[model samples]
Target: MSRLFVTGRSGFVGQHLEAALLVLPTADWQLIESARFDLLDPASLDAALAETCPDAVIHLAGQTFVPEAFRDPQRTFEVNLLGTLNLLQALKRRGFSGTFLYVSSGDVYGRVDESDMPIAEHLMVKPRNPYAVSKVSAELLCQQWAYTESWRVMIARPFNHIGSGQNESFLVADMARQLVRIKRGLQAPVLHVGDVDVTRDFLDVRDVVAAYLLLLEKGQRGEVYNLCSGVERRVSELIMDMAHLAGVTVTFKQNPGKFRRAEQRRVVGCSEKIQKQTGWKPHAEFSETLLSVLSDWEVREAH
Candidate 1:
């Protein structure tokens, strides 16, 4: 059986990816999560690589909060950038000759031009926020590893991924969680929102994980692939759709404080590269994604 070592096994994406992998039939793969403080302790990480000797490492552990990254840039870099370095170094030290999957974000293409509609992989990276900067830095680091050391690496830039098990801090989850509360009367009928007019390429976490697995199977080493829905939805429309799914009459309140600086008005990406390479296309429709998320929240609230 091939062993897969996942760095952020406890995160929302990590959890979903793990569950998805459990059901695959063609491959018998065992996923091992990081038990040590990844960025802070190098010795512990080295020990894990020595023991697991995994056939692949999916690096998912990092500081993901954009707003939080703005609040503490140093902390963001410490985890996203330095943490990635630690993992790469550990893998090198342990002499693990396996494919490394770097889970990056589409936010790396910050403040894109209108002509860059459906941003492609070749676009120049212009990270506006600390979170994007950190991800870009990590991507560069992974590229360096592939170029200098000849490590097999595939970088996946997944756009806004949403589904169940996601924390309420995220936009879609926040809307779903708030709608659940409003239905249960646990909170007011008011839903707090930041910039609802912004458009983003939101893909279901299921599709994103499938793309990751596809990358592992058919992706070219030393290449960067995008995982996107190729469909952009306004935040306002998403919340309204989610509210409609919940069958609730909720009022939305715009909280300026809740808004983050450097918020992009529109963000979309092209998954053509990945699709052409792996023949992977997203199957979940927007309505299905919305209803699924709301249904999951309702179940969670009932419990």
Candidate 2:
């Protein structure tokens, strides 16, 4: 059985990836349990590597929350950038030469012009926030390793991926959760929202997992791929769709606190690179994905 080492097992995407790995048909993958290891502690990473001796690794561990990164930039760098370096060093010491997939974010492409509606992988990154900065740093680190080492390393810059179990810090999930509460009579039928006028390219978490799996098998080493739907969707449109699914007439109330200071008014990423290379494209129906998230929140709120 192929031993697959994964980090960030507790995250939303990680959870979905675990579920997918369990039921995959082609390979007998023995997923190394994502034991709680401190990335900042080099010893722990080394010990884990020695213990697992994995054939492949999907690096998803990092400071993911943007606001939290703002609050603690030092810790964010220590984890996202230094933590990656530590892992690579540990792997080198262990003589590990295998496929390593580093999960990056589309946020690295901070702001794009309207002419660049669908941002490609070649676009120069202009990271605005601490979180995005850390990701870019880590991406460079991974690329450097791929260039110098024999290990198969690839990067995936996933755009706004949404699904069940996403943190409420994200606007989409928050709106869906609030709608559920309103439907259950736990709150009034008014939606507290941010800049709903913006547009983004959203890929479902399930599709994201599929792309990762395909990349694991077919992706070229040292290459970076953008995982997105390539469809521009308005935030206001999503809110309306969720409200319709939740069977609630929501009056919108703009909340200043919900807005990001440097929010990109329009953001959409091109998935052509991954599609062309790995033959991976988003397949989930938008409406069906929305309904599933709503249903997931309903269950969570019921308890």
Candidate 3:
């Protein structure tokens, strides 16, 4: 049995990853989480690494929310950048050299030109926000370790992933929740939104977790792969889809507060690298995915 340690087990993707790991029939994986260690607490981290000495690690623990990162850049940097440094040092002190996957955001490729319709790994990264900047910094840091040490370090830049348990701070979840409320007559038949004209690449959190596990087993060391569906979806269309799924007719209202700083107007990513190598691509149907999200909100509202 291979011991696998994963950070950020409390986050949305982390939760899904944990669930995915639990049901895999092909491999025996002993999953370890960060309940006993703090990323900033090197002593605890060192002790934890010494104890577990995980055969592989997926580092998903970091400040991911853009607006929150803007509000607290220092804290974001401390967590995303310094926290990763601490983990690396702890692993080094423990003489641990294994596959280390650093989960990064597609936001790092901020402000891509429209000509670059489907972003690839070779394109230059222009980070436009604190959250994205911090991710890029950590990506480089982990890549550096991959080059210097024998660790199989890989970086995954996942695009906007949506699922049942996601909070309303994001676009799809917020719209789904609001539509659920509108269906239940808990709120008005109106949707408050940001720039709905913008487009993004969406993938199911189920598919995203599958890709992460595939990468852990088959991904090339010292390389970065983009994790996305390769389909550009407009936020307006998504809102419409969710409303239809929730059986609601809604009017749109502009919410100025919903706008994020340095928000990319359009995003689509090419997962060809991961596909050709690992034979992985998104398999969830768009409408089915939306229905699951809507059902999630419906169940949440029932409680």
Candidate 4:
């Protein structure tokens, strides 16, 4: 049986992917958590790859804070850029010939004007923030690796995917967490929000993982694919959905202090290439996802 290796196995997406991979009977999957290989440590990474000899390496470990990236570009670049370089070096040292799946973000295509309704995979990436710049750099590194050494490097630019295990840093999860407190009367009924008018493409974490698995199995080499729902929803709509899920009337309190300096007004991406290439499509409804997120938080809060 084939073996699979994954980084960032403790993160939100990593947790979902790990659970999803457990049901696949074809491969004996192993999650090499941060303990197994620190992205910053080259020797550790090399040792892990040499020991596992995985058929596929899903690179998901990195710094993932947008606002924090702005605060400390050094840490952002160090973690996102240098960390990826270390992994590439480890793979080279191990002479590991396996399909590599790099989890990129739609943030790399930052601040597209309103004219560009649905951004395509071929559009030029003009990152507006430090985090995005680091991701763009990582993608370039992956491309260079593919052209020079490997042919199985696939990049996935997934839009806003949210589900269980997401922390309070993200908007959806933040809202859900706050709603839980409000519903339980632990906090006020008023919800703090920032830039509600800005729209984004949101996908369920399960669908995102399915797309990643499909790309791992059938995606073409040295190509980038977008994983999105091809639709935009305002943050206000999401907050309202969470409120509806909570079955409580909630008030909103817009805090300009909470807004980021370079917030993109509108963000959306087209998943047509991935859909056509691998016959993969998103299956989770937006409402169902909202309920699921709320329910997941509810269970955690209850516990």
| lDDT leader | 3
Q: 1-303, model 1: which lDDT tens digit per residue?
A: 778888888889889888888787865668865456556579888867776678888888999989899999999999999989998898888777888999999999999887889899999999999999999999999998989876689999999999988888888988898999998889898999998888999999999988888888889999999899998888888888788888888788999978989878998899999999999999988789888888888888888
- TM-score versus the correct structure, for each prediction: 0.96, 0.97, 0.97, 0.96
Candidate 4, 1-303: lDDT as tens digits? 556778888899989998887886653555543346788888888777765567788888899979899899999999898999998888777667889988989999987977776999989888989999999999999999999985599899999999988988889998998899899998899999887888999999999989888888889999999999999998898798889889878989998867987788988888899999999999998899998889888988887
By TM-score, is 2 or 4 better?
Answer: 2
Better of 1 and 2 by lDDT: 2
State the lDDT of candidate 2 residue by residue for 41-82, as single tens digits: 888888777676878888988889887888899999999999
Residue range 66-149, candidate 3, lDDT tens digits: 989999999999999999999999888877788999999899999999898799999999999999999999999999999999
Which residue segments of model 3 deviate by more than 4 Å? Answer: none
TM-score of 2: 0.97
Kindly report which residue stretches of model 2 are placed more than 4 angstroms away from their true locations once superposed: none
Off by over 4 Å in 4: 25-35
The whole-model lDDT of each prediction reads: 0.88, 0.90, 0.90, 0.87
Q: Model 3: which residue pairs collide? A: none
Candidate 4 matches the true fold with a TM-score of 0.96
